[model samples]
Target: MNILDDLKLQYKLGGIALKMIYWNVACFLVSLVFFYSFKVGVFDFPSWIALSSEPAVFVLKPWTFLSYAFFHDGFLHLFFNMMVLNFSSYLFLTFFSSKQYLGLYILSAIFAGVIFVLGFNLMHYSGAIIGASAAIMAILVAVTTYSPLMNVRLLLVGNVKLWHVTAVILILDLMQFRLENSGGHISHLAGAFFGFVYIKLLQNGIDMSKILSIVLDFFTNIFKKPATPFKKVHKNYQKPAERPVSKIVVKDKKQQQIDEILDKISQSGYDSLSQEEKEFLFQAGK
Candidate 1:
């Protein structure tokens, strides 16, 4: 298959993690087209699309809580986030179901977004945030929480514990907590925090992911198509001696010729037919 067809095939066959990556890539492409400003060298995401710190904006456009996680501001932002996402998804899916993975990704994003907005408002800061950093961190942290001692190998860093990788990321975010992009840092930490809470709750027999499933089922049922009723007909069985005799049918000269031509076509393909046979078959078809 060609490149595009191959990608389509992969998407169709891959699990939730690959589908999530595809979604992020698709959203990034969309943002590049409609939100990015070449002259300004930045994306100009609207309040409805990006999560705004302002209570008024987010409160009015509540969907931004989840929508913002799908968009990225630049190519590098999308690239690194996707790389981490692929890594985290691989590790997370190792010990969890696809449903749980999807639930954690979505729920953590909303949880982080809410905390980001609250933290920003408390600090009297006003800004917009876009990107899957928060959600990606949650996935990474969630799996790390579940399996802290799991071994992970890095190219330049050699082998290390999963928790070590998670800790380093959390530390980096904490170190830059007040340096730059404070909102981004806050959201990342918040996501990590949510991830820990999610695992804890799950361990305690409280699967918060069920909440998402319940809500989704509710909406799905609301829009679900009703099944059409089909009538069933029961056939009566009969003994061989008691069954009606089958009728014999005779084919006309033209039909006999057509059947011979069809059998020949089936055995040797349509191309094997002679010129007269082809013409006769064509005329018969008409």
Candidate 2:
């Protein structure tokens, strides 16, 4: 099929992380087109746009802090970020739910933006940061934290524990603190820290997904009518005669058999059952 169709297929089949990477790439492309067509400066792109004209070192725009992670200034920048995002996200989705993935992505972006801003302010760095490297770093950290002993194979390198990769990336970022793109490095570290914290919190059963759920429920309740009070409507309703002992016992026995069958289906594969059993399980699941 055509390229767009191929991409659509990939996105449909890929997990949440891949879909996120695709969104970032699409945003970068759109920003590039705007930059060229509208004569907007390349540095004015979403990722690294100047925060303030008067303050050269500040990068505090509300949207820039988060949106910057989705924009790239060059082909190489986009390529490496996408590669890391794809690989790390694959590992991440294999373990976490979609809500967890989305939460991590958003929090990672925010943490990265904050770190970038803080670093620029503290170190007097003047350049704006862009790209998803920080967010990808966060994903890498989360994957490694969740599955520390998991072995990952690089193209040229042999299989290595996931934590080793995490360690190396953190060290590299630490050593590169004085580089011109120090703000970006700091942001990556921030994202990595957030990922680590997120996993730790998750291990303790603290889910941030509830926050979004509550907000959605509030909005839904706002637009919906209140529940009506229950009314006791009484008519000359006569109680039915008691079921026969044998019939009642047989029906109860049948229900017990159905429950047992359903339990078995849940523990084993549906293919383990016959057609009649399959129908029974389907009806029960519904």
Candidate 3:
């Protein structure tokens, strides 16, 4: 299949894990096009999209708080972040649902971005920030929080506890906070803090992910096509034909499965479902 067909298939089958990765890659290509086609300087990307460290500029473009997570500064930047994101996505989904993953990701990014702005301003630093590091860090810390003792294998490192991995990373970020890339280091900590907070609140029965769900639904409804008003039909219109028994069973099964998925979403959030489960729900929606 072509790229479009492949994207459609992945979006329909690979669940949020695939969709988030697809977006980051797509945005990277778009940036490349914008860089070359627009003939801008090599490092001079448009500021409208990148999260600005300047509080004044940020106030004007609030959406950048979240948009910045989808952008990056270079090839290695994108690769490493996506790598951690992929790994974290898998770990996170093992315990949470896809919606929870997204909620944690987006909220962490927003929180990190805002804190980056505030922290930098306070520290007398100034620069724009980009990349999904903050959000990715959040996921890493979240999974670590969820299961501190979970062991992970590293290349040439044998195996290590998840908390050790997270702690080492956090320490590195802390040690570098006053050095180069202070903005990034600060944002990383902020994301880390939010990740820790996310799970704590979840345990306390306050799902911060619901805020994202509500926001997304509100926007979805706004962009959704308006429904047609009711109108009387002709009395002579024939009744609709009944579906075949086989089709009816399939339909009932689909609906029943969909209901179960929805209940899971209500209770534990969407990150709890397996990829196969997510794909089934995606197909059911169609």
Candidate 4:
């Protein structure tokens, strides 16, 4: 089979995280197509302008917060993000439900975008933040929270627990906070914090899925109508028919026999049973 067909098969069999990675990879390819077709001018579209300034120009442009996560500026940026997304998503889908998995992904992206905006505005960083590092950090934090002691065996590096891996990543982000791509690192930290906090809140029974539901309800209400009261239906009364005396008497006797049998079974173990008794017990439970 061709490589594209292989990827499609793998994607069909893969869990939620893998599917998301596939989606991000597809978006990256599409962005590349746009980049080359536009003579590499797409990458030069000021990240800050695309993310922050443009939204003010058009209210519908707020979706860039979520869309920007899938847009990478270069091949290296796309490759590392997809690698991290695939690994992290596999770990996430191993435990969480698909809905929870997606909720976390979107929430992480929004949190990352907010942090990126904050850094850009407050710190005056004109550079644009791209890639799935923030979302990957969120997944890492979530997996670590769920199974802190779960060992991940790395090639040549042997095994390490999830908590240690998260710690190292967090430390690296902290130490490199002032680097050229500091905004992206800050966004990663935000996503990581959100992942950890989200898991903790889940343990306490605060479902974040309800937030998505609320958003859905808001949009649905716009196009839907309110329910109207329905009048209750009434039926004409009719007389009942009578049963035969012999049939009624036989049914009462059978009920009494069944009750006695049940009482005997309650006093004795089911192992002390006759064929008739077994059938009676089975029918009674049913």
Candidate 3 Cα outliers beyond 4 Å, as residue runs: 36-41, 226-286
- Candidate 4: give the clashing pairs: none
RMSD of 3: 6.5
The top-ranked prediction according to TM-score is 1
Give all TM-scores, in the order shown: 0.82, 0.68, 0.78, 0.68
The lDDT values for all models are 0.88, 0.73, 0.85, 0.73
lDDT digits (tens) for residues 153-196 of candidate 4:
87798899878877998998999988657778888899998899
Query: What is the C-alpha local distance difference test score of candidate 3?
Result: 0.85
| Model 2: residue 11 alpha-carbon error in angstroms | 2.9
Model 2: CA > 4 A from native: 36-43, 46-60, 209-286
TM-score of model 1 (CA atoms): 0.82
Distance from true location, Cα of 191 in model 2, Å: 0.5
lDDT of 3 by residue, 1-286 (tens): 3446434754655668778998999998888777534454354557788888887898999999999899887788889889988888888999999999999999999999989898878878789888899999999999899899999998899899989988998999989977788888888999999999999999899999999999999999999999999997778768989867898888798789888877886578556777777677656656
Q: Compared with the true structure, what per-residue lDDT tens digits does model 2 show for residues 102-198?
A: 7777778877777676667676655567778877888899989889999989889999998988898899889887764777787888999988888
User: Against the true structure, whose lDDT is highest?
Assistant: 1
Clashing pairs in 2: 47-68
